[model samples]
Target: MVIPIHDKNPVSRAPVVTYGLIIANVVVFLLGPIAFAGPDPDAGRKARENAYLYHYGAIPSQLLGGAHGGHGAPVWPAFTAIFVHAGWIHLLGNMLFLYIFGNNVEDQFGRVHYLLFYIVGGALSTYAFAWANPTANAPLVGASGAIAAVLGAYAFLFPQARVTLLLPFLWFLPLRVPAWLVLGFWFVMQLPEFQQTIGVSSSSDVAYYAHVSGFVLGLVYAALVIGRGRGPDDPLRLRQKAESEGSGTPPLAPDYRSADPDDPYGQYHR
Candidate 1:
């Protein structure tokens, strides 16, 4: 399994929005049901947990023009669900990804645009899942869909950047892989599950289509924002230049080399 630990890419600006999002997610998860589950806490927490899921988590049926099913605050759940996670593992995993890839994406589009992109991507993902499973009753929660969007944007923007992956079977050996290879593979991997989940009329715990849809939205957003854009950092133009240099033949993807004097890691061309 390819587990991303970090990226070699550095940001030109401090990612305030990314940091805020991580903190917000942590705070919400701590306050949410996942953190309080002891026997003493369980009795009262169960009701709160149910309430949290119903009130904040996006129920597919409700989003797709179905009854509220007693879940209050149905309209706001689309945005709130982005911060709600089921467990510590879920919260931490999503936060880690956001932490890893968000900074650069935030740097790419400034703070405000990045924040807008994140929120919109999340809402779109939730809606996509809702469309896919209109009759299901499960309430989908977590930041995976949003984070997947970040991953998608990162994949297109820095396709050549090296992502450090922890390979556990090899004694937790660290392997640096290309972002395109990892993220592209990840997007492809989601297709089978997305296809399977598209027509089924059952309550699935995970909204795989949401993740897929969010990633696609991110890709489209990035393409529109970065394509034909005249900048060395723009991936689409760079790819086009590379292709042109190859006389229409596909050339080997080049690694993104850092040129910033402040970049402590210097330039990595592989």
Candidate 2:
């Protein structure tokens, strides 16, 4: 019920890569059987959908030792599957998350580094799922794995930022909360999914392994590589330290008083 709708964080640069990714997924979906019926006169809607998924989606069985039931090398699907989705709900959910969190992370890392991080994180996530469910025949699709990376990066870089959430029961009212609280809760909720049998894919409908692995990879990479081990942003603080030897009063903090318009703390700064 704690659905995130938006973040109070703002970015300095345009997120071309994020926008491009969304567009690409939309285009692919529109071209697929889900939106436009395929050219196969003999195939039914379900058959065409299955054919598309089998060809583009990543199958853990193929990724492991099983014979390739898909076209081309198995590696191709590992990457291509990032754009594929099982249904309209799947596509929209992933795209919504990416649009919400990707801007700030893209700005923090710059387009190039962020792009590489997203792609690699997604690819690795697929492999992580495949490793855990080596014998499972389900073909993994959708951009959840990549979007999870963006969520991790956003949580790291803007922990103090406020996220607006809309509860399904209270659809008319929006609640604003800290980024850390929201993202931390999200990561924690995924932990229990690990208890599902590792090699048994039928235990869960969602790819929890990929979701967790992608999140960890994004967070670790952001900390160690991109952010250089930097910790989360501290909240705005109030202090009465001596300003100068000559100045009698501790001089009211300039930044603390006059907040930047984009500051997440509203009227304060650290």
* Model 2 alpha-carbon drift over 4 Å, by segment: 36-43, 193-203, 229-270
What local lDDT score does residue 237 receive in model 2, on the 0 to 100 scale?
A: 21
Tell me the lDDT of model 2 at 159: 76
lDDT of 1 by residue, 45-138 (tens): 7888778787788888887785666655566778889999988778888888898889989987789989999998898899888888888777
TM-score of each: 0.80, 0.78
Q: Tens-digit lDDT track for model 2 on 1-270?
A: 367777765455578999999999999998888765534444578887888988898998898774667556668778899989877777888888888788878877889988888888898999999999998897898888888887887777667677777777885477777888888877766665444434323336689789888888888787777665333331112222232344433233232222345753443111
- Number of the top-ranking candidate, with TM-score as the measure: 1
lDDT of 1: 0.78
Q: Which pairs clash inside model 1? A: none
Best by lDDT: 1
The collision pairs in model 2 are none
lDDT of each: 0.78, 0.74
